[model samples]
Target: MSPHSPARRRTAIGALAGTALVIPFLAAAPAQAAPCHLSGSTGSCNGTVHQPGSPGEGGGSGGNSGGGSGPVAPPAPVGLNPNQGQGFVQVPGNQAPPPPAKPATADLVAQAQAAAAFPVPIVHTAPKGKTFVRLRTSLWVDGFHVVKTQPITVGAQTVQLTGEPATVTWDLGEATRTCDNAGSEDGKACSYTYQRSSAGQPGGAYQITATIRWNVTWSCEGADCDEAGGDLGQQPMQSEATPLVVGEIQTTTGQ
Candidate 1:
């Protein structure tokens, strides 16, 4: 066994090549991993194995390598007032908006008046009858009853009105009188007896005027009654005057 024999030399060269191949793999072998230690939401290792794409650390291809993502923009505020440069004012959750104000009593009455189409009462007594007797007088409304209802609107609110004839005033071209009751088919509820004949009066007749007074009441539609309810006051309507003749009893003496 020579120290440098051909077989020994060839064996030594093969061993060296094998050692060179194994040396590279041994150098790349991984070391024992350090026990991971946690600090808050992140972890740390004793070695330099850093998390990929972490802030202020470089590891991967594309990302913010050194700085944290720009401060997350805050959400825009809602219901901001343009006049005042302040944040939106928060209303109380339990509170609600107040309802629209009710219309005034006078306004309601005016609305009713505008909607009402009350016709003049017709004088039902004879215009050319003799006087000095208890002459019956009366009035009649063609299509109206004791109580009438009508709907009216004022602004944005709707209401109902009730109207009725309160009284019928008579002006006999001499004095005035009022009738507060309804009349029958035969005669009027009120009658005036002439003191004398119309012979002395102007034009040989008396002018008789009949006026009607209306009472109105109102209430909000689908709601409670308002101040316009219960005697909303009265309006007077009159008819043209009529003529009536009167005659005196004649006396004859024979000689």
Candidate 2:
């Protein structure tokens, strides 16, 4: 039993050999899942465990459990094309949206008539149905708004129409004249001088009339600009006729 004895050495060697065999068995044991606390019959294990029906690695439904880069994304749903884009379907640059439908001219004309602010002819001199033969009878009308068109929307496109006074026409029951500007109340424009009396006319007065003509245009914005656009031509509005009488002044020569 002495520390240096042959029997003691042999015993020490046998103990060392036993320790080596036990160390290999410990190393070969399966690793344990951390936080594996068991409470009664039900407990939780953090380590991977195969359920009775669950596929392990390549054995399960979606991907092979044997693994390379991780589970392949399930095949894109049937009939859907898979895209590499970030959640968006890429559109071709050459595809262009269709233009809006053209608006009906008749419909626009009706709308313009409803929205138009018409001007009545002002008989500056012939208001009382009488005027001097040698003096000019003044008549004019204001150039008011014809207003904006109702918005026309087709698909993703929209259009709005607008109008402006373009011409004015004057009728004196015998002659007609057109002007580039609206009639002026200053008597410099839209005045007519009677060369003769209105004795032969109906109601003993000549009928006078004034009309305003507007030109309409339309515009669009954004991607639909210039679509469903057109001109509405000349939309004319006339004022009621006024009866005017031209009389001659009789003066006797003094003796």
Candidate 3:
């Protein structure tokens, strides 16, 4: 038989046909997923987890959802869906809600005042803690940063009430006196003359209280400062009780 004969040509044709048939069996297989290595509370997906049944994905495809904008169960391979409360993947620290908004200016003053911790009034007296009946007892206060300047946050601005003494109303047991300023120990400004002695009272003393009225005005700053900043309204702060001994005078009348 010759090399160019029909028998030789037929054998070559069969070999080419066999090679073509095996090519379909050698076609590529579907890709295997990358393995995930979770180290701690936080982990990363080896490849992005494409959660099925999400918005664009058709309903009930891979997940149990009827679908619409709802959270679907994610793959458990990458530690997903562990902390999910609402059916979505819960990444730590990424889900914190925003903080509360600042209150309106009108509501801010009273709210700030209630929250502010202005110092309480400090009480002081003249006559070195003792006095004589029918004598000028000279009752007064030590003030000591009384009429406290309090800085409060109203909206975005800082408002401060005046620290200067306003009115100190002294309850002197027998009489009440209000001073335009912190009372003076000298007989001039805020002196109170006791008509009766405190000898009959408990511990031979009169328990005195000073109520300080603070100047309430708010000065505003910052770009958001408003006309609402002025005159937040006055508030009264009372002082702790102080003790004063009043002794009766002994006078000898000529017989």
Q: Against the hidden reference, what TM-scores do the models get? A: 0.49, 0.49, 0.53
Best candidate, lDDT-wise?
Answer: 3
| Residue pairs in collision within model 3 | none
Better of 1 and 3 by lDDT: 3
* Model 1 ranges with Cα > 4 A deviation: 1-106, 126-128, 132-144, 147-149, 154-157, 223-230
Candidate 2: worst-modelled 10 consecutive residues by lDDT? 62-71
> How much lDDT does each candidate structure score?
0.61, 0.63, 0.66
User: Ranking under lDDT, best-scoring first?
Assistant: 3, 2, 1
Q: Candidate 3's residue-wise lDDT over 153-177, tens digit each?
A: 6556765545445788889887888
**Candidate closest to the true structure, highest TM-score:** 3
**Collision count of model 1:** 0
- Candidate 2: list runs displaced more than 4 Å: 1-128, 143-146, 222-228
